[model samples]
Target chain A: MEIKLLTEHYDKKEFRFIEGYKKLGGYETLKKAFSLKPEEIINEVKASGLRGRGGAGFPTGVKWSFLPQNGEKRYLLCNADEGEPGTFKDRLMMERAPHQLIEGMIISAYAINSPKSYIYVRGEYNYPIKVLEKALQEAYDAGYLGKNILGSGFDHDMDIYRGAGAYICGEETGMISSLEGKKGQPKLKPPFPAIKGYLGQPTIVNNVETLAAVKYIIRDGAEAYRKYGTEKSAGTKLFSVSGNVNKPGTYEVPLGYPLMDLINNECGGMKNGAKLKAVIPGGSSAPILTAEEVQKTTMDYECLAQMGSMLGSGAVIVMDDSNCMVDMLKVTLHFYHHESCGQCTPCREGTGWIHKIVSSIVNGEGRLQDIDLLEKIAQQMMGRTICALSDAAAMPTLGFITKFKDEFEFFVREGRSKVKEVRAHA
Target chain B: MFKLSDEGINFVKKELARYETKRSAIIPCLYRVQKENDGWVSPESVSYLSELMELPEAWINEVLNFYTMFNKKPVGKLHVQVCNNISCCMLGARELTDHLCKTFNVKPEEISEDGKITISKVECLGSCDTAPMMQINDDYHENLTPGSAEKIIKGMLNGN
Candidate 1:
């Protein structure tokens, strides 16, 4: 069943604007948050068990606790850069409920004692940015923002930063670099963003969905919020279901929902009654699951992780039997190659080499040895970079070849795709 | 030779002071430059912006080159960007792109002879449910068939 804790009013057109949102009981949480101590709000969030809705799945409350008590200037960044393939939930969230996000950010900012925050959105999101801009002005005009917001004596300021076309900027540190007016490249860890980030200040970066969930955590209290999801993965998640499903759209379900039930009950099963072949349970970077594995799978951080795949951004891409695995791998590789920041060598070269190998196979010049070469290159690419771009490229490459070796070998030997009559390489 | 209008200059000045550090304004300033100068940024404008912002040419150039939204060369009046990522590809986005190129009589990434349209295959625009979609300038045209996409482009050309 769909749980609409954060997305209850998403369907209402008035939810997008301040007048509509307030009528629907919006910004009520901000008033509630003001009545409590900052630490009290943090404790409530800690008790809520709300994990990061972004790919990393870090604990939201734990991330906030990392800020040093010594009063240093702090920054709160909202990662609105939703670039992962097969994911469009953030786009929907921003478009439907901009003030919802704004309210959440203000509350989060108060908990962390930060005065300034930026919602770093991707440049391709022209429509979302415009909607957010209008909503932000309304927020400021209504005094939901600016000095002593809601008469709580907690002053906060928020702005929007647009990123040019780079997928690497979705990484937290890379986002910090882009906000700093530099090339969007991922910085090294051990000086994590919570400790020192965004112009060498203690920064907390949360995804659009994760920050939006904060308002609910404060409103419903921690115990009520934990009732929906499992012990570890508490609360509902918005999954962007695409590719071959009859109902290909965003659906919000409680955590630990059965993977098959979402497809059969919610998505109306496969389009045109096609048989399911493979599923990328997370985003494209996650390892693909065979149809059999997807049957027993449940959508949660722990279940997907135990299956050697992580619940990354909750982008469930369903592939029916008619799709060619070789063709799909080529398209996936091309994206990583194009988006690799080149700051790390393994990703830069490995992504290119793997993409070229797949392209050659699709073009009917692949050798049998090329299959093994793909695996060898992918294995070396993992854990050898500043960010997971290398590993992101490597994981799916490894997943496709290991699970669907027959398709690759047949393409190499027969010089054509096994599923389609004509070549589909672009 | 490439100079901002008085209003564009003032917009850049406001952006310069928008963020904590002056260097953070480069992204927004480059966006302003792209808007005023056709649909892309030019090399001459880099020098012009450097002089106007009192920043190094290298710093501005690095930022301009790093991001993909800032087109380096001139594009047509209508920049048609088709999503060719995995989800869209599965839904015949490649065929859609080929269909648009043939109908418009232009190659990918090249401006038409009439200079009104340029079709480029890009990565995902995050609209997977509405696969086979295209973004023309600032607006997105989603859930398209080949016939529908061509019709929409024709409508825009006729100033609808």
Candidate 2:
């Protein structure tokens, strides 16, 4: 069943504006949040067990607690750069509920005592950026943002920084680098964002969904918010379902919702009743799951992880039987190659190398040894980069080659895709 | 002699101050240049934006080249970009892109003979729900068949 917490007002077009959102009793949580002490709000979220809805799945409250105890000016960045392939839920939330995000950010900023925040949105989302800009203006006018918000004396300033199409910028430090007017590249950790980020200031970077959910946590209190999802993965999540599904779109469900049920109940079953072959349960970076494995899987961080996959960004890409695994890997590798920031040697070279080998296989130039060679190259690429882009490229390559080795071997021997009706290449 | 319009320059000025640092405004300013110019950022406009924003020329150029949205060269009036990534291609995005290219009598990333359209197969635009979608400039034409996509392009060619 669809448990619409953050997305309840999405169907209402008026919810985009402050007046409509206010009519739906929006920002009431912010007013209520102001009454509690900052530590109390932090403790409430900590007890709620709301994990980061971004790919990482870290506890949001625990991440906030990492902020230094001193009154050093910190930054709260909302990672709205939704560039992960197959992920579009963040775009929907921002387009439909900009104020919800802004209100949530204010409460988070108040809890962390950070005076400044930025929503680093992707540039291609021109419409969403315009929505957020207008909503920020509305927030300022209504006294929800800016100095002395609601006369609570918790001053804050929020702004939107547009990201210009580099996928790596979705990473928090990469986002911080982009916001600081540099190339969108990831920085070394240990002096993590909480310690040093974005012009050497302590920063708290949260995904758009993670920040927006804070409102609900504040509204219903921690216990009520934790009621929907599993014990560890509490609260509802929005899954961006696409590919061969009959109804391909965003659906909100509890964390432990069955992956098969999401397909049958929400997506209206497979398109044209095609049989499911494989599924990329997370975004492109995650490992692929076979049809049999997907049937037993749930949409939580722990369940997918135990299955040797991840619930990355909750982008469930469904592939039907007619699709060729070799062709799909080629397309996916091409994306990572194009988006690799070229800062890390492993990612910069490994992604291109993988794309070349995969493209050659698709173009009918693969040796039998090249199959294992692809896996060897992909294995070395993992955990060797400044960022996970290397691993992102490597993980999917490993998943595709291992799970669908038959399709790949068939292509290598016949020089034509076994599944594709016509020759896709040559 | 590449330059922004008076209004475009003014918008760039406001964007410079819109962010915490002037360098952060490079993306928005480059977007303004792409909008003012014929849908692409020329080499000279990099220098022009460098001077206008008062940021380093290398910095402006780095950001311009890093992003796919800021076209480095000229595109057609109707810059049709089809999302041929995994999700879209699984359905019919590749076939749609091929059909569009054949209809326009141009290869991918090339302008037609009449220069009315340019088709390029791009990465995903996050609109995976509506597969086989194309972004013609700022607007999206989703859930497309070959015939429907052709009709939309022809309508554009006929000044619709």
Candidate 3:
């Protein structure tokens, strides 16, 4: 069953406007949030067991609690740079319910006692940026923003910073760097964003969905929110289903929902009644799951992690049998190669090298030894970068090569994609 | 020689004051420059912006070069960016790009002879559900077939 905690009003076009949102009880949560003490609000979030929805799955309350106790300037950054290959939920949330994200950010800013926040959206999101700009104006005109919001004597301001075409900016530190007018590169993490970030003050970067969910957490209280999801991964999550699924869009089900159920029930099964071959249960960075393994898998952090994959940004890309694994890896690696910041040697070089190897193989010039070389290079790239982008490139390279070795070997020997040949013959 | 217009200069000034530090205005300011300078940033504009913004040329150039959105070269009026990432590729995005390139009589990343259309393959634009999509200038046209994509580009060329 779909649990519409955050996406309940998403279907309504009126939800995009402030008056419509208010009619549907939009900023009421902000009012509810202000009534509670900041500490109480943090505690409520802590009790809810809500984790970051932006790929990392970190505990939201724990991250908020990391700020220094003394009164110092702080910053809240909402990571709306949703660039993962198969992820599109954040864009939908922002486009459909701009006020929902704004309301959530205001409440979260109040809980953390930060005076300022910025939604670092990707540059290509021209439509969402326009919507947010109009929504921000509405928020200010209605006095939901600016000084003494809602007469609680709390002052908060929000702005939207557009990111140019860099995927690394989705990283928390990379976002802060970009917001500060730099090249959007990820910073070293010993002094994590919680301790020192965004102009060297305490900073908290949450995903769009994570910040939006804060409104619901305050509205329903912690215990009620926890009632939906499992013990570790609590609350509903929006999974962006794409590729060969009959219906490909964002679906919000509670955590621990079966992956098959999401595919079979929500997405209406494989497109054209095609046979399922593989699934990238998370985003592109996650290791791929065979159709057999996907049967027992659930859509929670722990379950996916145990299966050597992750519920990354809750992006589920379904693949039918007609697709070629080697060709798919080529496309995936090409993205990483282009997006690598080149700040770190391992990722900068490894992404390019792997991409070249895959391209060479796709061109029917592969030595069987090249497959093993791909694995060796991928294994070396992991855990040796300033960001997980190195690993992001490496993980999928390893996943596709290992899980679908037979297809690769056949391609190398026959000098053409096995799946393409089968489709051609059929 | 590349200079922002009066309105463009005023927009830059406002952006400079919008952020905490004037340096934070680089991204938005560069975007404005690209818009005023025919869809791409030129080398001379970096120097012009450096002088105007009172920031170093290296600071402006570094930002302009680091991000892909700021085109380093001149492009067609309609910059048609086709998403050829994983999902789009599975839905025949590569074939779509090929078809557009052949029909438009321009290579990928090259402007058409009339300076109207430039077709380039891009990564995901986060609209995979509507796979095989393309972005022309600032707007996205999704769920595209080769014929439909060609029609949209041609329609734009005809000023429709």
The best candidate by lDDT is 1
Interface RMSD of each: 1.1, 1.7, 3.8
Interface RMSD for candidate number 3?
3.8
How much is B49 displaced in model 1, in angstroms? Answer: 0.8
Model 1 reaches an interface RMSD of 1.1
Better of 1 and 2 by TM-score: 1
Better structure of 2 and 3 per DockQ: 2
Per model, how much of the real contact set is kept?
Answer: 0.78, 0.71, 0.78
Give the per-residue lDDT of model 3 (tens digit) for A29-136.
998888899999999999999999999999999999999997999999999999999999999999999999999899999989999999999999999999999999
Record all residue pairs in model 3 with backbone atoms less than 3 Å apart, i.e. clashing.
none
TM, every model:
0.99, 0.98, 0.98
- For A100-172, candidate 2 gives per-residue lDDT tens digits of 9999999999999999999999877888999999999999999888889898999999999888878889999
lDDT of 1 by residue, A284-333 (tens): 89999999999999999999999988799999999998899999999999
Angstrom error at residue A126, model 3: 0.5
Which 10 successive residues of model 1 chain A have the least lDDT summed?
A: A417-426
In the range B1-160, model 3's lDDT, one tens digit per residue, is 8889999999999999998889899999999999999999998999899999999999898899899899999899999999989999899898889899999899999989988888899999999999989999999999999999999988989983
Q: How high is the DockQ of candidate 2?
A: 0.68
Worst 10 residues of 3 chain A by lDDT: A417-426
> Which scores higher on DockQ, 1 or 2?
1
Q: How much lDDT does candidate 1 score? A: 0.94
Residue-level lDDT tens digits of model 2 in B78-153: 9999988889888788899888888788889988777778899888888999988998988888899999999998
